[model samples]
Target: MDNLPDEILLTIFDYLPPRILWSIISKVCRRWKNVVSHRVITMWDYNKVLKTHKGVVAIFGIRHQTSRQSPRGLAINFHTLNIRELVLCDNFPLGEMFMKSVHSIKTLRHLDVFTLQNLHTGYLPPPEVNSIVLNNNIQPGYLLNLARRKELKALHMYGRSQYYAVNEMSTMIVIQAKHLTHLTLRCPEISDPRWLVFSQCINLLQLQLYACWSVTANGVAHVLQLPKLQVLHITGSRMVRITALMELIPTLSRSIVELNLSASSFSSQHIALLAATLPDLRKMEVWRCDLTAADVLQLASGLTKLEDLDTDVELNSVDLMYLSEHPALKELRCLYEGEIINDELQAQSHIHVRSALTAPFPLRACGEGPSAGVLLHAHAYKPIDGVTLTI
Candidate 1:
């Protein structure tokens, strides 16, 4: 072990958890210490280490005062390490000095921050950052600054507490629309006028909207103009009528591959409309929508390309038996209010069946916003069908 090269030792260290790497491996020798110091460590592990060893600023080449009240508590030298991603959780101190230190890191490409406050004062991300996730209390002008960056590709902003300056937000979207491929917004204030700005974003592939109640049929009509859109999710948007959706189905039929309308009211006609119009859909989620056993059968029969189905539609034993023998379906997730069923269907038909008291929709995690995991690892982002839940 002593004669091993640094490269071989680093490879071995990759398999060990951060706890062991920090507590045991780094203490072995000065050579191992050098390699470990430069290793890519997650912010979670880094925070845990800081909590375990309080007032130890020299560990990762960060020099700081131990005093909690000190204005300049933390100062990081970006030259000492290769930090590629930065995630600032709600627990982390978002003091001015700390933010300044974070801004100096030129290698950062992805940033995830939660519960940002007082954004009107001025907060700018690193120029090189290409993906960003901001949650709660964001200002429109601050978003405009981020949108102006040419490198930005994915932006996810969630919070209902934003200032309802529609014009500023619309301008920001128009500025960055062509560059962004993945976008998610959860603001109730954004209505038809603001949504119309998204029509200029001709390159969008994934778009998710939540709680935009003012967005009526007119707004959705403009959004459907995106020629490259493949994934569409419209949740909690009550103003969007089913008739409007039916009218616009043909516009998105060819490009759309994944659709989620969990909060919408659905009927047999709606299901039949989707099956008839969108033949390329592979994953469909309608958990909270009204659906029946016959509607499910219609979906299974017409949508031959569906591989994953998540719905709240109640099914009898006969319906389950028929679904088990579905040719294309590999996974089924449904809500069951009563006792959990045995894996008899799964065993018989080789389909993975998951049941829960509530819908296992992947809208949000416990304390985090939508797609928190995907936002953290946004450098290699790929659209997933549905996030699995452990029942």
Candidate 2:
């Protein structure tokens, strides 16, 4: 039924993102299914392949499996698994057991798991019983060893605050993964960064810090050592103590070029200090945080590299005119802070600035991580800033 050469079709299919290809193929007739499932098929797309597993299919997509206990559980072919990307998601009873089984896949280069929180260093399987282990905080040394392996490239973990001891427990586990280029932590209510992990990963280029425990002045200072890092994300920081930022901002302002301090506050000194020090910053985001128009004036006044700015405050035509003409201004974001932010009496300052930060990115080449799209979307703004809030 096909007139085209096999090689041509294979090449076109190979370029498709595995996740998308799998979605279409899985719905076709049975003969096609058998061919597509073959282990030697060279292009095993496990991106969304996790969804196709019988374990996931049984729960009907709503719940990931706690374990592969059922006789109907689909067997995963290690040869077919592209170990470079693995997702170990748990939805039920034996989650830890399932993750432990995945740990055995030796060729694994990237492993992403969403598991319960723990107090020990490295990744921990379900809670263990024993006062002796708990009292001494004895961790299975294997996890730290896992962290040190030379091959692992990315690691992501999220857990409940009740199970974590903050930084005291995680520091060694993190530094051990010396080759990791991407790291994400979603634990909330952390009090310190001592166990914060990731010190020797000299190659680390991207980091996502969401609802992670707060950094003390010392913790903030420690972040300055991450010289190779390029992108930063700080969310859910209302609980963040101001003292920690006061200590941390001076060190961070100069080093990071892309800063995302959304939903947090910075003092007058921090705003002013960062404004002058961060000469290299290319993009910035400030959302739902309390910073007066004056504070905004102080922080953003000197940032020539800033291309996009987002905040939850009001601004008027005068305020718009000043920012619209400012030397560094390109895109402005407002979050309808009950009333617009810029005032009439003080808006004329930017009438002559005319900042030219936004440039053209073809978007033909995609970014390396998840938030890459957001960065591209941020560029689609101008200082005659737009405001929208989700209800």
Candidate 3:
């Protein structure tokens, strides 16, 4: 069908499975190749497909169902295909083949390699890869080599189970990742010395650490010096010195706007410290922590720019009323699994919430307002149904 129009050819190609389209159909003719380059979308999940009969045949592009040949028997033309993203599902050998055989290296931008078997020689990534997510127990030397991929802008590595804790290699990697803006580490084996490696990511805007216990107060204080940091989320970290966190609050730059803390025991004093430190915080969330009504009130009183607040703290009716009346709180969600709010408190919130819901807005001139309808942010409280407040 070289004679067919591009639209019709695209519609026909769309009916074929992605595996056949990419491997078999795209290479049929020059016209098909050009159309497939723009029309075909590639997102392969290796494990789920290779387990079934059709999947095996589709992935290998077997000509006949009765063929007894393995996938390796077929020489797939990865060189001519246009692949946008590649996800390796713990298949290190397959990953190695793809990296080496794929001639369209500069076209590949997002690469996700989870659970690396080992760092085999001659299996390096392409230079154009920008985002990488690694969840394998790779050696420090291997990690250092992967860091050498100079174009990486986002790097997420989970190395908690590795035999060797990250040391100088991690620091060098961070130093090399000059364009890295987002960094996530789930390695519990990372010690304070390794945590210091993060300070070198000067262009970093978002930082997320999970279960990294070796991060000390000094490490966090040093990270706070990053001027462009806007979002910081830390959870399940035990070794982070709260004393250091409290002391370094004032030192944090104004770019810090969103903060999320969970699975940590925090007192009223800690809440007060946060209020003093983050007066311009736009969103804050505290979960599974020890906090009282005074702590919540301190947050309500101090943070005037807060639009979203969520906490599992126990709050009384008066505290709820004061928060509902706060000018900046556009949405407040309180989750109390340990104890339920009493009926008297619920009734009060319902009445106040109803009033808030029906509060009038200045009417816009005819034909000047939005064509569909005005979107409103509704204030809601749980365990008290039928209470919807809007502004």
Candidate 4:
């Protein structure tokens, strides 16, 4: 081991986990310490290491801290490390200082700044950044400036402020509408004519709106005009009027593949319309919607290409038996509290059944959009344990 060159040693160290590399390998020798210091290292909530041709990129989750004190010596110097993506979650103490230092990095492309409470004043992404996900209480003026950047391709902003700046947000959407392919907004104050601006986003593929109560059927009519939309997720919105959904389904039926309407009021008729119009639908999530067991069965029978289904409707043994025989359905996630007697059926079934008291899907803080490699490393799905099935 001592005879190996620095290049070979660096390559070998890249495969080791962040904990081992930082604690053990870096202490072996002066040369090892020097090489390890130059590698990608940052504070994260969990230990995730991604190995690339250049070197190892370590993603560490930031632990929640009660005090305002920042972690000593943990501030990232972007000029030294070649970080391609950075995510700052809620309760991060050094968010402002850290964001200020990010301007030095030349390789950064994706930046996600999410804060539920703490507001990082004067926070802004550098000019090179193209994809941004913000869930902070930032000023609308800052967002207006961000939208004017011609290189911006993806923008996701969650509503956390008491006042919604409709004019500024509308202008932002209009400026970048032509270039953005992925856009998500959670504001509840946006409605009607403002939604008309979205029609200009000709290249949009994925659109998610959360808790936007003011956006009625009329507003959605405009969004359906996008030519390339494929994934549409509208949760907790009062846009479930039957007539509107039925009329809008056909416009996106041929192109849409994934649909999530969680926490919305969707009836049997809506499900029928979706199944009939959307032939290519593969993933559907309707948790918290009112649907009978028969409606679910009818949906599974109609959508031959459906592979993933998430719902809150309780499925009896017979329903489980029917789903077990489904040729295309591979996974079913049920968010039910009561006991389900399907032990025997589950043992003999090929479909994976998971039931939890609560929903497992959380609002992702980072690792989505164009960077496939980073998304895989940051947001890999972990299955949650379900309640014990009896009989």
Best by lDDT: 4
TM-scores for every predicted model: 0.73, 0.53, 0.61, 0.74
Pairs with backbone N, CA or C atoms under 3 Å apart (clashes), candidate 4: 44-60, 44-61, 44-62, 45-60, 45-61, 45-62, 46-61
**TM-score of decoy 1:** 0.73
Lowest summed lDDT over 10 consecutive residues: which window, candidate 2?
A: 382-391
Off by over 4 Å in 1: 1-79, 159-164, 337-340, 356-391
Per-residue lDDT value at 113 in model 1 = 50
Error of 2 at 381 (Å): 26
Measured with C-alpha atoms, the lDDT of residue 256 in candidate 3 is 83
Q: What would the per-residue lDDT of candidate 1 be over residues 1-391, giving only the tens digit for each residue?
A: 8899888887887665333555567778888877765563333223333332221212221212132423243334332333544444443455667667767766556665543355543566677767766655666577667666665677776433344366766777888877878777765678787787888888888887655567787887887657898888776556767677677666663688888776665557677777877887898867555567788888888888888887656776677778877778887776554543456754677567666334322434311223332332233221121221100
Local accuracy by lDDT, each model: 0.60, 0.44, 0.53, 0.63
Candidate 4 accuracy as TM-score? 0.74
Q: Which stretches of candidate 2 lie over 4 Å from their true place?
A: 1-73, 77-79, 88-108, 115-145, 148-151, 159-162, 165-168, 174-177, 186-201, 210-215, 233-248, 253-255, 262-265, 297-301, 316-333, 337-391
Model 4 agreement with the true structure over 72-141: per-residue lDDT tens digits: 2234433455665555555554455566667776766667655555343366788887877665566657
lDDT ranking from best candidate downward: 4, 1, 3, 2
lDDT of 3 by residue, 1-391 (tens): 7578998987886566444566567778887877765644332332222233211111222111222323232114444444444444443344445556543545655555443365443455677766655545555466656665565676655433334346645755566657778776654577666667778888877776655456666666667767798876665445555666567667776788877665444456676677777788987766555666687778777888887776655565566777766777766655333334456655545322222112222113111111001111011111111111100
Q: Considering TM-score, where higher is better, how would the candidates rank from best to worst?
A: 4, 1, 3, 2
**Which candidate tops TM-score?**
4
TM-score of 3: 0.61
Misplaced by over 4 Å in model 3 are 1-83, 88-93, 101-103, 119-123, 159-164, 240-242, 307-334, 337-391
Of 1 and 4, which scores higher on lDDT? 4
